[model samples]
Target chain A: MIRRIAFNLFAWTIVLAVAFPLFWMVLTSLKPQFELFRRPPTFLPETWTVEHYWTLLSSTKFLTYFKNSVILSTTTTLVVVAIATIGAYSLVRFRYRGRESLAFLVLFTYLLPSVVLIIPLYLMLVQLGLSNSILSLVIAYTTFALPYALWLLRSFMAGIPEDLESAALVDGASRLGAFRDVILPQLLPGIISTALFTFILSWNEYLYALVLVNSDSARPLTTGVMNMLVSSFNIEWSLLMAASVMMSVPLIIVFAFLQSYLTRGFGAGGVKG
Target chain B: MAEVVFKDIVKSFGSFTAVHGLNLTIAEGEFVSLLGPSGCGKTTTLRMLAGLDFPTSGSISIGNRVVNDVAPGERDIAMVFQSYALYPHMTVYDNIAYPLKKRGVRKADRAPMVQKTADLLQLTELLRRKPRQLSGGQQQRVALGRALVRDPKVFLLDEPLSNLDAKLRGYMRVELVELHRRLGRTMVYVTHDQLEAMTMSDRIAVMEGGKLQQFAPPNEVYREPANRFVAGFIGTPAMNLIDGTLANEAGAWRFASPGITLTCPPLTDDAVSGPACLGVRPEDVLLGEGPIRGQVQVVEQTGHENIVVVKIADGIRLTGRAGADHVWRPGETIQCAVDVSKAHVFAAGPSGQRLNRPLTKDQPRLAKEGA
Candidate 1:
């Protein structure tokens, strides 16, 4: 009984340790501006108000930034997943020289720190006349997401038996038809997971969004939040925490529903004798 | 239905050859099996016939039209893979109807055709289920139904029944032969199991090391193997091969080894008289009173007959069948005999080609009765 009590205490301590920041953020977001700067922080708000959420929803720039984030992340995910699926499928199925090295190179690029690419990507966006545009952020996010997406999806494609495509060919379907009809359907889980990962990465991204876009017309939520931190000397803690809570809701909802597909080997029962 | 011919086909992957200069003509309405061990290029040959893998050189013609440059989709050949390769996301009905859908067949026309195929394979009850929900045998039927729905000119099955249980494999073998007769289409099957090839194929092409060893009807391949490899490969428990040298001793043809000698059947004048290997089937290894002496190693009773394993000489073991009524034990001395007429003599070389050609059409068994 004593050991069980000790184990339960340790587990709860870890859970509360991880969850306390979010708990505090919610409490602070609900508190009025006066209670936030108190010397002794209030564990729970004495007076709750929806004014911060109301202000955020009413502000036109906040809505525009939210829309920009949705557009950039969605476009990045679709483009990255499509290109990575095709690139991964070709790398796994077709025979060519330097395929192993090419796959290794993709992984190498995926492992590189994203900070290393920011300056060069910024310069490239300027050259392409896409600076200060959402297109620049979309292009930059895809460049980073594509390599990891290819690496993950390639392994998933390899698990699928090669015989499925060969059987499709022998059944009088063309090569592209076989890939579309047989391979792509089985790769659905991998593709979904890739899309989720790329979308979340772009949604949470700050560096590329800050350096590339300059104005409210093209700014995403990440840059918009950072702009709020510096635009006023006295930071609006309640408003900032409220915006942070809203930004994280979609990711939580995606994970809650599609969590099973994120587990590896989703194609297990897809092929058998 | 169409006849498929592979003329001087060679398939190589970079420096290594998978099939070397293969020439085979599969007639319409006939079933031929390419039988060999794994890595002997049987599956590669079947893949080439299906146009999945193009040959490194040489042309293939189907019904007198050369398909050298034709893609697999345009070739009109249906294949069943070893893994079944059923479309897992689709139901049985959709799986069977995919080829027709690819060909732009009307949806109304495809339903009855898929239904007919499902009925043919006895899979009508499972049309609504996905492949993962079905048992292995059911999955196999779905694969067959998928191929049968197309009504292609040729059917290529690459070890289709290799994944089934033994009893189900036997049952499906009979079903496949009946299906062939009902459809009367040209079929080419690939398998490593000799029993599957022998029992199902009208003709068997025995291959080894990327080359054809012999191509003949099933019984002929059994009775008159062209080389030692075919003789050793085609039978259960394997044909007994005893290495010896042929000599003209006292003006009589004889084969002599370390501990045994037998009168060799007459060979043609052109046959070489040097080192040779003698082969005899297990059932022909008579185990009564005979000149050859051996020690019984083990006796196994397999329902109908008992298999007696005997160590004939140093490191040479021969297996023969005895009646279940006859009792034998391990470490017992036994005398055996072989009917000289049933013995096969092969040249002792890397090729192991048959060296003995019988001089007459009819040759009686020249061993003592009930020896």
Candidate 2:
């Protein structure tokens, strides 16, 4: 019993060590401006305040950046996940020459660094007259997000038994009908996890957002939050912390609701029947 | 019900031919089993009949209409996969109703059909439960219910009972036979178990190495195997085959081996005097009181009988069945006799053709008595 308690204590210490930055961000976000720089730093604020949050909502372009981030991330996630699901299904199921090579090529694209493609993507977006817009960010994000999502989903698709589809076919369903009725429902857990991963990837992405979009109106939270810290001569640490705390709320909510499917999805992939 | 036919069907996967030059005509309402070991193309033939696969050449027909170009869904057949393959997301009712729904049956009409099928399979209480909620036997019944709900003209089953426990397999065997009797639909079953094929099917098609070895009723297959492969494959404690030579001695036929010689009964005109294989089932070998002598090697007690293995010569063995009451032990010298009336002679080598006439030409009479 004593050994278990000591082990648990050690485990919790590791957990707190990892989670300490997030906890400090939330605490600093709630502290008053003067309290942030106090020589004997306080664990709890002497004067607890929402003034940073209030200013972030009303006095700055924080809401505009938040809205842009939401639109850009959601659109990129939906489009990438939609295409990846069908592509993964085809890669795992249908028989044709070069199918395996095509799947390999998709994974190969993921190995290329995002920074390497940013200049070409910027030029293409500008040529298409989509520069400095949320649309450009969505396209830029797909370059990295699509390959990752397809590789993850392809393994998930391979985990389902081929007998199920053959049974559906002999039961009088067309090929597409069998896919809709059998494959899609079975693929729901995988789709949810892939969508969540894509959403979070787009939500936290920085490089393409920095390189592709320059106008303040279309900037996402990554650049928008950085602008306040870098562009200002005197930094408001409290407000920056408050923005960090706010940026993570959507991800926390998503994680809470889909925790089970995320574990199941990861467990099912790459495991043969 | 419809008659199913395969005419010169050949299936090739690139350069490897899975099935070769197959021709079969399954009569209407007949339950035919394609029996063979693994990789013997039995399942491939069933898949071709179901339209899941198309033959590389030749044609397949159902009810006298060529169905080579037809889609699987339009072929009016249902298949029970070896895995059961129940939709994991759907309830039993929805699983059974899916095929009807695909055929555009009205929802109200579909309910009665599905309910009737569920009731027939004793699955009424499981209508609302998903497949994962049921036991293995219950899942098997749901698979059957799904296939039965359509009332298709033909049913294709690929080793459906192979996954069941031994007791359950035997029980389901009877249930399937009854189901076939009631439905009277053409059923093509694939299995490697000879007991299952012999007990359940009206006719058995024995295949090996992508070729049909023999196609006959179970009794005919047992009594008169067309080749050595069938003779060796179809019996439990398989028929003991001894290498020997047949010779004609002054209007008498004699079979001679290393340690023993036997005078055989009058054989048909097809019997040739040359190297041959002598096949005798254990049951037909009398355990004691014969001219041939040998020492017992091992005795296996099977409650009702003892399977006795005797070494007649160096590297030559013969298995004989003895009554359970008569105890025998290993290393005991014994005399046994071959019941020549029921013995079989085949040409030399593996897959040799049967060279002697069957004891009785009573296949049709036996079939009539069986019915």
Candidate 3:
């Protein structure tokens, strides 16, 4: 009992240490302007106010950046998942010349650092006249997300028994129909987790979004928050903290909803009958 | 409902031939079992018949239509897998209804069909439960229901009851035979269990080393095995084979082995001589006062009967069954009579072909000699 208590105590300390910054961000976001400049920063706010949120929601371009981020990330997710699922399924069920080479290429590309490809991707998008637009950001993000998503989903697909689809086929359902009615339903958890991972990665992606898109209309939350810091010499710490908290809310909600599937989906393809 | 035929079907994976130029024909509504040990290509042949695997050469026809180029989905056949591959994600109702749904059956039409199948398999109350919720037997029935609901021309089952417990497997065997009698579909069942094939099939196609060793009724396969493998594989406590030679002593035919000799039936051409293997069933040994003598090595009483293992010359063990009332003890001198008329002589080679003897009219002296 004493050891358990000690372990709990140690775990709680680490958890608090990790969670303090997030708590302070939300706490500071609700503080009035004078409290921010206080001599010894108080752990708890003496008085809570919504003025920073009001400024972010009503006066600034935060909502626009939020909307752009949603559009950019959702597009990336849809394109990545659709392409990767087909690529992964093909890599799993079909055998042909170069099948091994193709699978290896996916893993090799996933291991290649995205930083090395960004410059060439930027130049390609510029040549296509798609720079400064959300389309360019969507395309660029999908390129980086595809390889890893394919690798993950391919392993999951390999776990599912081929007999299921073969049984379906011999029952008079077409091959594509078997894939739809049998394989896809079993892949739901893995597909959702893959989508969630790609979405979060695209949503928080700063480098490509910053380099490819410059206009306020297409600027996502990552660049939008960074713009605020550099916009003036006097950075409104309150506003910045509020925007950070606001930006993290969607991701937190998404993770909360998909957390079970994320862990379960990764463990699924290891051993099955 | 329809006959299936495989004309010279050959399936190979790269250089390894799983099945070699197999030709088989199943009559309409005949329950045929492809029985063999593992890797003998019985399942591969069944898969080819189900259109899951394409043969490297030769043609397959279902109801006289060539299906070599057809897709599995278009083959109009259903298969029950060894794993009973019921869709785990779907409920029993949905799983049974899926094949109908795929064929574009209206929703209104699907329910009644599924209900009838569910009732047939006694799965009406469990329709809402998933496959994981069901027991092994229940899952097996669900798989059968899924296959039977389609009313396909042929039903291919690959070790369908192998996963069940021994009691359940025995019960399912009877149920399967009854089901075959009721449905009368051209069913091709594949299994390694000889008992399953013997008790359930109308005819058993015994295979060994990727070749068909014998295709006959179970009793015929037991009584008249075509090769040494079939004879060795078909029976429980298996058929006893002793190496011997056919000898003519003083113008009378006799079978000679070490420390034993018996009068043999005359060959038709009188050409079956030299080395041969003598096969005898355990039940054909009458345990008392006869031409063969041995030392009893062991006695195994299995409820109603005793399996007596007797050691003859040079440590050769011959097993014979005795009634429970006959008490046998180890190290006792036992004398048994060989029912020579019920014995078999197989050529001493890999083939082990059964040698033919002259008819009763030509072998009148043999009966007189026995008397």
Candidate 4:
């Protein structure tokens, strides 16, 4: 009886430790400016107002950033997932000279730190006349996402036995037909969550966006949120906090739904390949 | 109806040859099995016939048409894999119906064909369930049903029953043979289990290191194995082979080894004399006072038969199949008899390839009791 109580207490302590900051953020976001800075931290504010949310809506480009994020994340996810699924399938099924070396090259690109590529990428974008375009961001984001997604999806595709494809072929399907009818459907789960992962990663990314874009016309939420944090000397803590929390929402939702398969993507599909 | 022929079929992965000029012919409506261990290229040959993998330097023809360049779908062949390969996301009905639909069969004609296949395999009730919901035996039937619904000219099975339990495998063995007989389809099966090849196939093609060792009727493969590889691979508890020299002794052929002198059968002419291996099946090597003697080293009982491992001269462990009724202890000196008439004599070939030519029509062959 004592052991059970002790175990429960220990587990709850760990949970509370991790969840406390998010709890504090929510409480502070609901409080007025003065209550937020109160000497004694208030778990629950005496007076909660929707003013901070209202201020974010009316005074900031939070809505524009939100829209940009949605468009960028969704489109990036779709394109990255599509390309990775095909790339992964090709890497897994088609054997050609230097296939493993090709796959290794892609992984090497992913291993390159984004910070190191920022200057060269900026120079290329400048040369290509894509310096301030969202298309440039999409292209840049895909460079990082493609390799990790390819490796993950390759492992997933590898788990599905080649026999399924051969069976379909023997059953009168051409090679592509077998892939479409049999192999692709089996890989849907892996592709779905892999896309979500890439989208969320690109969505929350700030370093590349801040370095690449020069205008509000193309800035995504991550770059826009950095704008919210500036005042030369005085940071708008309430506004910055509100936008940060809002910017995190989409990523949280994507991660929550795709959490199950994200862990399994590498472990299940690494065989056979 | 298609007669599948593999003519000098050779497949190589880079410089490593998996199949070396394998030659075989499957008559229309014939059931033949390719039996070999892993990496022996039985599966590769089956895939070549199915047009999944291209052969390196050989021609394959199905139904008199050279299908070396033909696509798998156009080859009119169906394959059931050891993994079953049923689509897990699809129901049994969807899986079985998928092939027919892909083949562009009329929608109006697909339902009855799928139903017929389902009924034939006794899978009608489980059609709505996904593959993971079904048992291994049921999944195996679904794999067969998927192939059967195509109504192809040939059926290829690559160790289809290997995933099933032993008891279910025995049951499905008979079921598969009956299905083949009922359909009269040209079916090719591959397995490492010799018993499966012997019991289920009309003809067996024994392979070793990608080369076709022997292709003959199952009874012939069991009794008249052409070489040492087939002789050792085809029988359970394996055939006993004692390395010895053949010489003329008093106008009779004799196989002389250290501490063991045995008479060779008459087919072993003086011209056939050489360093040879005396081959005898465990069942043919009787345990009694007749010629040889050995100490019983181990006795294994499988309810009906006793497998006695005897320690003979030259540290050669000879297996003796005896009755379970007569129980014996280990370390006991046992009188053993070598059925001289049944012993097969073969001149040693390259690295254990014992040479024993197939007897001519007029030549006397080894008897079951003597072999």
**Top-DockQ structure, candidate number:** 1
- lDDT (Cα, 0-100) at B335 in candidate 4: 77
Which wins on TM-score, candidate 1 or candidate 4? Answer: 1
Off by over 4 Å in 4: A1-7, A255-273, B249-252, B268-272, B324-329, B349-371
Q: Candidate 3: which docking quality band?
A: acceptable
TM-score of predicted structure 4, chain A: 0.89
Which is the better candidate, 1 or 3, if ranked by DockQ? 1
lDDT of each: 0.87, 0.88, 0.85, 0.83
lDDT of 3 by residue, B81-177 (tens): 9888888778899989988988888999999999999999999999998887788889899999999997988899999988899999999999999
Q: What's the TM for model 4? A: 0.92
Per TM-score, the best of the predicted structures is 1
* TM-score against native, each model: 0.95, 0.94, 0.90, 0.92
DockQ of each two-chain model: 0.63, 0.42, 0.38, 0.45
* Number of clashing pairs per prediction, in order: 0, 0, 0, 3
Tell me the tens digit of each residue's lDDT in model 1 across A1-273.
999999999999999999999988888889898988888877888899878888888863678888999999989999999999999999999899999999898888878887898898889889989999999999988888899999989988997899889988877788999999989988988888899899999999998888889888999999897796446567778899988888888888877877776674355554674
1 or 2, which is superior by lDDT? Answer: 2
Model 2 Cα RMSD, Å?
Answer: 4.2
| Model 2: per-residue Cα lDDT at residue B71 | 86
- Of 2 and 4, the candidate ahead on TM-score is 2
Runs in model 2 with CA error above 4 Å?
A260-273, B246-254, B263-275, B361-371
B-chain TM-scores per prediction: 0.96, 0.95, 0.93, 0.93
- For candidate 3, the iRMS in Å is 4.1
